[model samples]
Target: MAHHWYRNTTSGNSLQESLDELTQSQQITPQLALQALLQFDKAVNSLLAQRVRNRVNFRQSYGSLTTYRIGDNVWTFVPNDVEFSKVTALIKVDKVKIAACDDENTGSNAKE
Candidate 1:
């Protein structure tokens, strides 16, 4: 089974909660709710792939990497005392987490 990464995000979680409520209220069947969530995943992934065009790159400096992990082609980094620099802004923070996923294994079901 492919991992539906978006389902763990805030919006996805909200949708799932709403579906659960609908299922509990007998407004929708369990199977239909499941299908709806699956479609949500597909639609969101497809839209992001097609609509999002601009890419921003940033470098983190003056930071110490507190934690690093790699699993399922996903790279996670947690840094402390970091300064992130973009094109026009520089932001400093005490800590931040960054997650990166490889495109081929993003588990998106969108077919071009």
Candidate 2:
């Protein structure tokens, strides 16, 4: 189980700037690992009967994780593998383009 900073309903494109700031300041990974179990899988059928719980409780000291989503909050899917984990992901959340600045203050002048 994993928690990603779901910035928007359609896509996570708009979260590039904030995510980068967070990644740098917090020194945390930008990628989030997601997992899904088949509803028909017999190995965990009993536990899957309830939708209330799917992941472990958020432990603040472990990782900066949350189950909340921003904006309209709708479910979407992306395909991948079953052998993934959050601890191993390294997503690049920063946008590739350089910003054209006018009176831009990047906190470079902040007093030390």
Candidate 3:
């Protein structure tokens, strides 16, 4: 499935929930739970960074940025921009999907 804006944060929340469950169940000490949650957060951030790299790389195959599924919206990401590292965290601003997909010089006139 394609990655969305809420995935990593949801994952972090789930991690904390699991830690709470473990601590309440007496399976782990509170101190250990805290350490585990911190470790999990670090790992998630690293994984998210790798995912961002993969998305940037995969974006090269498609010459035109006319692919998205949130109400049939389209997104265009600028490759090699340091700002793009935060792609997964930012809200979708490119929501215009034109009828024509064969041309790269099309206008983003459609709005959801």
Best candidate (score: lDDT): 1
Q: Tell me how candidate 2 scores on lDDT.
A: 0.30
- Give TM-scores for every candidate, taking all chains together and pairing residue i with residue i: 0.61, 0.17, 0.37
Q: Point out where model 2 deviates above 4 Å.
A: 1-13, 33-112
Give the runs in model 1 whose Cα sits over 4 Å from its true position. 1-14, 70-74, 101-112
lDDT of each: 0.75, 0.30, 0.47
Looking at model 2, report the run of 10 residues with the lowest lDDT sum: 95-104
Highest TM-score: which candidate? Answer: 1
Question: What would the per-residue lDDT of candidate 3 be over residues 42-111, giving only the tens digit for each residue?
Answer: 5654664477543321223324454533433343333321222244653233233223122112433321
lDDT tens digits, residue span 1-112, model 1: 4446788899999999999999999999999998998789779878887997754544567668899987776678888887756668777889888876656534533221
- Residue 110 Cα positional deviation in candidate 1, in Å, after optimal superposition: 15
Please provide the root mean square deviation of candidate 1 (C-alpha atoms, Å).
4.9
Ranked candidates (TM-score, high to low) = 1, 3, 2
* Superposition error at 68 for model 2 (Å): 44
lDDT of 1 at 107: 51
